[model samples]
Target chain A: MNAPILWIAVPFLVGGGILFLLRERYAAWLGGGTAALLALIALVIPIDTALLLGPVSLKIAPSIQILGRSFELNTADGPLLAIIYGLAALWLFGTEASGTANRFVSLGLMIVALLTASIAVEPFLYAALLLEMAAMLVVPMLVPPDQKAGRGVVRFLIYQTFAMPFILFSGWMLAGVEASPGDLGTTIQAGVMLSLGFAFLFAIFPLYNWVPLLMEEASPYATGFLLWALPTFTTIFALDFLDRYTWLRTTPQLTNAIRFAGVFMVASGGIFASLQRHIGRILGYAAITEAGLLLLIIGLGSSEIINLTFLILIPRGLELVVWALAIAIIKGRIQSLRFADVQGLARSYPVAVSSLILAHLAMSGFPLLAGFPSRFALWQQIAEGSLALSFWVFLGMFGLLIAAIRTLAVFVMAKEDAKWEWNESWVQTIMLGLGVIGLFILGLFPQALQPFLSNLAPLFEHLGQ
Target chain B: MVTDTVSWIAVGLALITSTAILISRDWRVSLGALAVQYLAAFWLVTRHLPLAMGSVKLIAGWMVIATLGMTRLSLMNLEQQEEDAFFPRGQWFRIALMGIVVLVAAGSAPRIEAAIPGLGLPIIAGSLLLIGGGVAHLGITSDLLRVILGLLTMLAGFEILYAAVESAILVTGLLAAVNLGLGILGSYLLIAGSSPLENEDEL
Candidate 1:
């Protein structure tokens, strides 16, 4: 049996079938169960070897071909697959609580499958088209049947579509660059096209205007899923590019550019987040800040950067899940997500408000939360390299902290006569409560992730070396 | 591969139809022009791709136009039946801008050709016109239908140029899927945007 077909294709087929055969009430269980099962299978299957399970021995092939093209998922991909599918299950499990179970479970699973396929597809340039297809799938989820498609959705589609040709064209030029490494013009042209394509894909700096707009427009849970899925895969794809091209990795100028972009995003995202009055938009900017932190790790170009990047990323999925759940819960109670609209909501939905605050503080890199350990390592590395850069990064985190404090104040603003209550259902309370504990556990003992994240860099021949 | 004469004709038709789609105010007329533009793109793709794969481009394009057509037809109203000219108040400005873009594209064709060898002057010019016109359309309007048309036009241009560079079957298939998906999404947005429920909810 082929691993790519088993992991990617099977989940896709199951997701499509679930949309047709299953009722709305069963979506969360079936979808989450399917995702969990896939994650478990991915975790158990060994690449390049046979596995003994009870009475049976089975071997899974690494690659599957269709129409002369290939999709490959090898041994090195096991951890990545486990992380993706596990996070997907977490999101799917919360769909019922978020009130988006109907379409979210089905379409969300398919989107995850397509994105995983993008990472596995051979020639790698074909990944650009697959990414575009995945982005298009996000449209219906972002814009509900009853609501008009917002500017955020349109811009998201346009920017994603725009990245496709650039990346494809760059692939065409990159071949020329490889054949004629000494050709300056070819190298420059290829490098510019590649960076342009990635900038659009990553939504770097000014291009990231759509993130907050989308947060304000779409269901927070769905937007959170997009936030987690696209960038996580794209960053891996970017690392693959750097690993494959010696010229790109060795160029100091490229690394410097990455550093500047990272600093700009973190600094800008922080400043803007501090000024925002809307809770959803604040989370959007906070996401931008986290993305910048990941870029900063990539820019450091150190031996430990890959593990550090994954460390940053693992907590990110949980934080977003918790945060988006809180937002969705509050949104169901209030018409708007502005600070004013949610005033005194803490008096009603204490669990959701507490979850939102903890998640917000976690993203701000507060001590003993999921985000702190990675941020600490990142600061140590950056401080050792350049104190000014570290300062800017800290400033960005400070801005996020201020936003968190302001949000808390807003939620605390209730009439003296207002009585505290538990507005959340038992399910939401349990799920959110568990998420908060997970964040704290992961924060205190980050080494638990070491076994999974330690060897990921070796997948790329020269990436972290 | 297509002959020089066929290629030039296709390029010319592409330029005309894309312009018509941009300049036409009536949604039905714009979609009609878009179909013709797709046929022109298909002709261009045939020069680089096999007949079956090239036909996918044309079929996907028409499918998009048909999707939009059906959505518009479903929402037709007697009061909205009157034809309206796109950029009616800025006809001269739009015409002059188009003329300037054409001239600029014509001048830059050689430079672009030099930068990426083997792509002919016709392909370069046609792509430039489509891309330039599409960007202008996007900048000038926020209307859902118009924006969708602009995006489709830009994608067509990219496909034409990209076809000359890579002829992978999977790429072609994926691009076709993107086109169809865009159309369905555009149609859904157009219908949703026009719903009376939206206004009622807003109030």
Candidate 2:
């Protein structure tokens, strides 16, 4: 058995089959169960090594060559895959709750598998094509079944499509750099190509206009899933670029560029988020800030970069889930996400609003929440790196804090005589409650993720140094 | 001598066809221009790759055009089909952009050829024209069909250049699949967008 077949091909085909054959009622359970199972296997089974189970010996091959291209998954991938699929399972389990079960179940799994294949693909440049495929798959999931397509969706597709050529061409240029390392012109060209590719891919700062538009147009739940999923995988993809290329890792200017992008996104996303009256758009920008945090993790000294990156991703997944789920629930009750429209929403649906507020605070890295520890780490790094950058990061967090307060005031604008009601479905309540509790537990303890984060440190062989 | 002539012809064909796609008001004409642009791409791709492999670009690009055409046909009754304008919106600006693109391609092709050994200047220029034209198309319009057409042109342009650099069958096949996916998604968007919203303000 090979790792690529097990993790990439199997899930891909099964996800496709589920898309065509499975009933919607059965999809979340079956698909989520399959994902959870895959995550379990990844955690338990070691690749390219022998294992004796009862009476039989099994070895999972690390690499497989297909049509002159190789896809490899090594032992270090276990924790990473486990985290990815585990997160997929969490989101899938909520698919019905979010009313996106039909396509989300199937497409979500395929996207995960395709992203996994992207990282595994040799020539590695092929990862760009795979990433594009994953982005294409996201379109059907995002567009409303009966509603007309939104401008955000179209822009998303166009912008993502632009990234591939830059990346592929960059790969071709890098081959030249590999042959002659001293050629400054070739090096600069290749670096520019790569940075442009990532800039489009990450939708750095101003290019991320689609995020808020999409949030306004699409379901907060589905868009949330997208805002969570795409950037997470793309961040990993970016890190792989650093890990594979010695020149990329060794260059201080590149790392500084990454830090600049990180701070710029954080500060800009947060400030915009604070000023927005639409709750959905705020979530969108908060996610932008959070995505910036990931970039900041990458830009930090490489020793703990991998650990810190995965360490924060776990909380990010939770925050987005709670945030998206709360918005979805509230949106079910209300017509629009505008604060004016949802004034005194806490009186109507207390649990959903609280979850929304809590997730907002957590995303902004408020103390005693899931986001604090990671934000603290980043603060320390940025301080040591540059205080002006640190202040900008702080300003971003302050903006998110303002957004959180604004949201709170809107939610609690009801008269004192107004009564609190529990309108959220029991299931949604339980889910949100659990998600919120998970945040505090991870926030308060923070050690629960240590084992997984430690295991993930070795995933990128060169980045750890 | 024949190869050189075919290459230059392909470059000119790409430039004209891509510009037609940009300026044409009718979707049919734009799609037809895109079709001819693929033929030009195939001709240039064959300069480095085998006939069997290079034809993949032509076939894939044609299939994409067909898929989109069929989808547009399916939506014709539902959508209020647009007619040709005496002067289309942004027509002059598009022409100027294409002129600049042509000039840029003309200037850069030789330098790019020198920088990357084993690349032909004519093919580079042709590819750049397609990419530049597509980018201009994307920048100019927000219509669903036009956007897809523009993206396809851009991908075709990149594939022409990529074929010269990497000839692996898997990569070629994957790029073809990506083209088809984009086309299918475009068609889906067209059909989806054809259905009018209940209210103009509805999200």
Candidate 2 lDDT over B22-123, as tens digits, reads 888777888898888999999999998999999988899899999999988877664444543222467788899999999999899889999887789888
CA lDDT for candidate 1: 0.86
| Candidate 2 residue spans exceeding 4 A from truth | B77-87, B193-203
| Count of residue pairs whose backbone atoms collide, per candidate | 0, 0
For each model in turn, which proportion of the native inter-chain contacts is also found? 0.51, 0.64
Model 2 / residue A357 / CA error / Å? 1.3
lDDT of each: 0.86, 0.87
lDDT of 1 by residue, A1-465 (tens): 888888888888888987777777898988999899988988877776887889998998999887689999889988888888999999999987887846788889999999999989999878998898899888877887677888898889888988888898998888888898999988988989998898989999888999999999999999998998898888888887888788887778888898889998998999899999999999999999989988888888887868888998889999999999999998988899998899999999999999999999999999999999998888889999998998899889999999999999999999999998988999899999999998999889989898888757667888777
In model 2, pairs of residues that clash are none
